[model samples]
Target: MPRSQPAIPICPPFPISGILRAARRRSDLSQRELARAAKVSAATVGRSESGTILPSINTFATLLAAAGFFLAVVDPDGNVLQPMKTRDDLRDGAERLYPAHLDVIPDPEPGEWWADIYGLARPPETFYRDRRRRDYQRRLSQWQVRVSKHRHLPEPRLHHYRDAP
Candidate 1:
């Protein structure tokens, strides 16, 4: 059975999606426009901002890239606390070159832990690095693909939703 996200915390207030919404507004892009740029559906953005959605890692990454932001939990002075990447970005990259294995399979024995050939310890960073690498490769490939296909892709303004169709 799949587990669900814990209830929203009341104190420090996890409002990353709010940041996305604000960024989208700053970009002057509608939900549909942001969705298209992010390669996700507009409803996804709607749900996320409304707090009805718990975005996958990859989805969040796409949103960040689309909204022109990077993922980093930082202190008031801008010291990075947690570096994060979206799962969708990694999965998409993985899908392009190799089969994506972005998920962590839980140990059935509950106490068991296994290290893979990559020498990743019991708790591995493979999942994070895999997504980050994939995100970079996918963006690079998309740029190449577009340049080869279209002679030019404008100075990267917000993509038209109709263009996606």
Candidate 2:
């Protein structure tokens, strides 16, 4: 028998279609114009406005940003979770609230670039030298361990000594 699964609580549906249409009209952009501005397909925008499908989060944000607006999270009681009036305000809020953490970057590509810079890629010479040093040190430690383990035993007579009369 199949195992019983826990019920997933249903989230209240957001009126994404209506919002998309209203925002686009307020921005004075046709569906095609908004699509072009947001770098998404025109058909996708049309479909989203028609409620046939919801656009991806990225698409939604792109479209809204094109209209000088953005999305914000709110608590279950409808209180804004991270309220801010502008991009700079958001930056200030994060800096004040989470000082030790990194600054929030709006662009996605730079985050990936930072990941590469962090550890995945390195300067060629430095990486090669560090890798070689680590390998040599590891091998030296292993050899020392092997030698210590057998240090108490007498050396076996060399089988290659043919003239040992």
Candidate 3:
């Protein structure tokens, strides 16, 4: 007899969008209708369904309320899921982090592109530094908004240059 491969997990860690979609379907609610009930835009529902964006904590709470489901999330196996908020999880779960460097470089001059390619004009180092700072601030703001609605959870601590040598 041949050995069988192990079964893979069918559900995702969060699967917030899937949960919302299921609830909406069970209620015969259109995305626009659900969004209206949740006091959010239809685009929000569409994005959530597509897994393109994770709703903020407040938004999630509102959605669950509208769907008549408790705010708690559960795994497919009926296990209650704990919050998985962490730097790495956020990095992976979010659409994208604010770009660390916002300096947009144009294509090099037509004929001179290959000449001293390494010496091409680059944005000032300070430009990158400023962009990094701004990105950090933007992330912090989002974190703050999330934590505000989840008052029971400890706030995330922001550390600058955490991995810099």
Candidate 4:
């Protein structure tokens, strides 16, 4: 029997159409002019604004840039979130990215590595930690610091809201 493909989740429509229209107005650019600047078809700009089509992330960002604006990711407090740094220098024997769940150690001492038992010489500066040992150390630190009892709490209520019935 042929295997069935998993259903891809469809995202609900966003207010990107309105945002693009507003940005175009602010930049004083017609749809055709914006399209020319963004190197897209005028129909594409029109359809995007009319909600007939949803632009891909790259296309949306390009259109916004043409309208003298840029897209950004921000928190509820309006703080811009920075993207995670890429560590191109770090990799394993197969050159695949280190497992994100585990901590990676660099230049470990001899006999500390599992592959050392086989007497295989590893590439320079490549090292790994035992997952169980790392987890044990993390748990021990949490217990010593009593992290469970003092876990993060929500912000306090405002003074005005405190008196509200």
Candidate number of the best lDDT: 4
Q: Model 3: per-residue lDDT, tens digit, 65-141?
A: 78777676676678997864333222212444334334322332433223334775532121223434555566666
lDDT of 4 by residue, 16-115 (tens): 9999999999999999999999999999999999999999999999999999999998765789988766587778768887877665667767876678
- For candidate 1, which ten residues in a row score worst on lDDT? 104-113
Question: 15-64, model 1: which lDDT tens digit per residue?
Answer: 76787888888888999999999999899999997889889877887897
Could you tell me every candidate's TM-score relative to the true structure?
Answer: 0.40, 0.42, 0.38, 0.58
- TM-score preference between candidates 1 and 4, better one: 4
**Candidate lDDT values, in order:** 0.63, 0.64, 0.64, 0.78
User: After superposing candidate 4, which stretches have Cα over 4 Å from the reference?
Assistant: 1-13, 100-103, 109-165
User: How many angstroms is residue 122 displaced in model 4 relative to the true structure, after the best TM-score fit?
Assistant: 7.1
Model 3: which residue pairs collide? none
Where does candidate 2 clash, by residue pair? none
Q: Distance (Å) between predicted and true CA of 6, model 2?
A: 17
Q: Pairs clashing in candidate 1?
A: 57-86, 57-87, 58-87, 58-88, 90-131
- The candidate, 3 or 4, that scores higher on TM-score is 4
RMSD of 4: 11.9
Best by TM-score: 4
Ranking by TM-score: 4, 2, 1, 3
Tell me which residue pairs clash in candidate 4.
Answer: none
